[model samples]
Target: MAVAKLLLLILGGVAQLYGQTPPNVRPPTEHLREQRGIERGLPFVKWCCFASGCFSRPPSSSHSRTLPHPHSLTISRTSSHLSSSPKPPRSPSLPPAFTIGILLCVFGGLIRAYCYRALGAHFTFELSIRPKQALVTHGVYGVIRHPSYTGAFGLGVGMILCVFDRRGVIMSLVASAVASGGGSDNDQAVVTATLTCVCVTLLCILYFGFTKRMNNEDAMLEKHFGEEWRAWAKRVPYWLVPGVY
Candidate 1:
């Protein structure tokens, strides 16, 4: 089941890469961009997601690591040591947490596709109103005013966890390095602190940015569409999540 899920994710991701329509690229206003707070996190987050993929594969008898084996390290306050035992073989099964994250990734990916179809060419990564663009209110928008953002938030959570979990990319890399150098537990502690800081900052930035961006869009649309926007806002009061602001 885990292999099947991973296969599905890989196939879906490949298909999306081949034929995805990117959101509108027009830069948002300076004020809006500042409120967005995604300038740095965007690429940082993406790099983390992509780099984490190399750690996901099961170790095959056919392949070996150039660096110290990530799983060989045992760091303690007294010392860091490497295991001398030959590695045991394992299947491609995923951790329960990772499996849940992958599910969220797929769910969010589908919702993003839905939003792309619904919005057509109006979807913009940065806040920008196109000339004479019609307001989109049917379908997902009927449930929540900012469905794309909901998908993004879900996707972002999955992506972050995939790289930051206990048995994840960060720990794997840190373990390998520590094993090679005989580093202390402090190294792991520092990494943990950094990861926690990044996650907290990411959540805060995204929350404030999504909220600000949505309201900014609403204000712009209301100005442009007059009663049309007002009626839609009246009908759907929620922003990203339904019934929870």
Candidate 2:
């Protein structure tokens, strides 16, 4: 954990150093030549010299002014207009949902580790139980029959949120809209809503499938342990949740 924290701090420091301009640093100035060329309606050009010693030059200013060109291609210096135009409002910083997700992932991983440690000799990658394996009804196992599955589910949720889930998407859209100095458009709102629904549907599907698999595993355990498993099940009653399956 200390190593992880140190690594995170290092990465954050590096990102901060590289990602943002220093307060003391001034914005780059436009070159006088480029500004003059723009004002004279000349096409922007770069002088390139090859190893073979080939060179090229843009047309002279007089010839450039008389040449027919699309209006869209013309460069206009509208610095005053731009400066006067209403700037988009700075977006308010959002709660650190990604950090929360990372915490969840860490917590889930710890839970899984605890579960495995509690299982000890009985812990197996496969569903099959060893001949002398005893029922684990202490620690996390006491609370949930499938503690590993609970951890796995938590990990899945954490990963979803960490990457780009409904929460992240909504936060991004809200931030973008706020930065653009307006509320989301109807189309954008619709898309957001649709994506949210899809995310929910996918979560529900995963939950349903996981529960179905757990039920099958429970049946297999019951067959293996018979009355012992029945009594434990009666005591616990729930698989992943307390008082709720």
Candidate 3:
């Protein structure tokens, strides 16, 4: 029994020594082997083995410096560090032109709403055959037959106000003149001077031509509403510009 107890104690001591390493133990050489395996993109744990074919125990921490291969951790760190910056936010600066545009938009919206309300059931913003549609003489239509178009023209002026500077404003005015056949832009300011002359000439011509056609429209209305249209015509003779007819 004494011999058996001694044998048991010896076996226990040997088992303990083999199972647990010393507290001050250095990193195993297997770490180098593991690192090498990682450098070649191989599994460190699978390749880890003792010379006598015994498999090594895993490191205590997964994040330990003892990788299966030497440089596997390095490659991971580098790849992670090389990521690009994410997308940036947009600027909040409002340009002068944009500001004016917003105001013009608001004015246009208000005008449209007023016209719609004034016209009520007879109102149609589009060119549709509302043959029975009565002439709108109240609100905006009392002065201008096409108040919406007048508002649109005013809105154009409002848009020009949004220009960043006086140069922008002048350029815009010149562009408008060109569009209206008021004048062309020469290299000199002569074009701007001529713009007014051309615009006035064009306006007189349009007034005679277009206004005559519109007056003829009153004849058609006269045929429909007869004396009623005549009375309205006398009250609001001018179509676009108010009080000048």
Candidate 4:
């Protein structure tokens, strides 16, 4: 039952990401965008999209020469389809943490979907507001100024947690560490401490990146929309988390 939830969450998220992508876009442009990202700074802007199977190798590159328009995306295919990855060698099952991660992913994807519907043509992974784009305030935007960034942060953290299960990388490392200690009580404590530190570090890093993106978006929207943006921001003081952020 729990595993079903994880798979369904992944699929639903993928559907939202890919189904919303405009078809006229292509992959070589995406490659060029990443190249520009590398020149500007770290390429973490699209990290959450990867977790939900949004990035894929561009089909033959001959189709795309010009950079894709800012409003439209060119995510070519979904390489990490759940039905396609090699059947994970079975263990007892996915961990409780994996289920927790799945729930977070579901929550995040639903938020993104809401933003998509709210923003309509303005919803995009790239960060450029269309000319005369109205500042969205209904739905999730009514409470949070940058709901998309909030959703992306949750999606990234959930992806990290999902990797700590039987079929993922973190658990394998944990098991090895547990074995190396000869199963001592001290080993258990050390392992727990180390794992906690690692997870916190990762989540913190993801949060920081998303926060930066949100701040940038806020500045850009305020510049573009002027007083209209200011009014929306005033009403929705929170960027990522309500009452906390």
Which candidate leads the pack in TM-score?
1
Write candidate 2's Cα lDDT for 90-120 as tens digits: 4332225445545555565666667767876
TM-score: which is higher, 3 or 4?
4
What's the alpha carbon RMSD for model 4? 15.8
Error of 4 at 12 (Å): 7.3
RMSD in order of candidates: 6.5, 23.0, 39.5, 15.8
lDDT of 1 by residue, 128-214 (tens): 566668888888889898887787676666655554555554556666676667665676677668878997887787688667667
Residue 67 miss distance in model 2 (angstroms): 38
Question: How do the residues 124-184 of candidate 3 rate in per-residue lDDT, one tens digit apiece?
Answer: 3222224466776787678876565444333333333322222233444444454455332
Error of 2 at 240 (Å): 1.2
Q: What's model 3's TM-score?
A: 0.36
| Model 3 weakest lDDT span, ten residues long | 49-58
State TM-scores per candidate.
0.68, 0.54, 0.36, 0.63
Which ranges in model 2 have alpha carbons more than 4 Å from their true place? 1-96, 165-184
lDDT at 230, model 2: 96
> Candidate 1 local accuracy as lDDT?
0.62
Going through the candidates in the order shown, the clash numbers are 0, 0, 9, 0
What is the TM-score of candidate 1? 0.68
Between prediction 1 and prediction 2, the one with superior lDDT is: 1
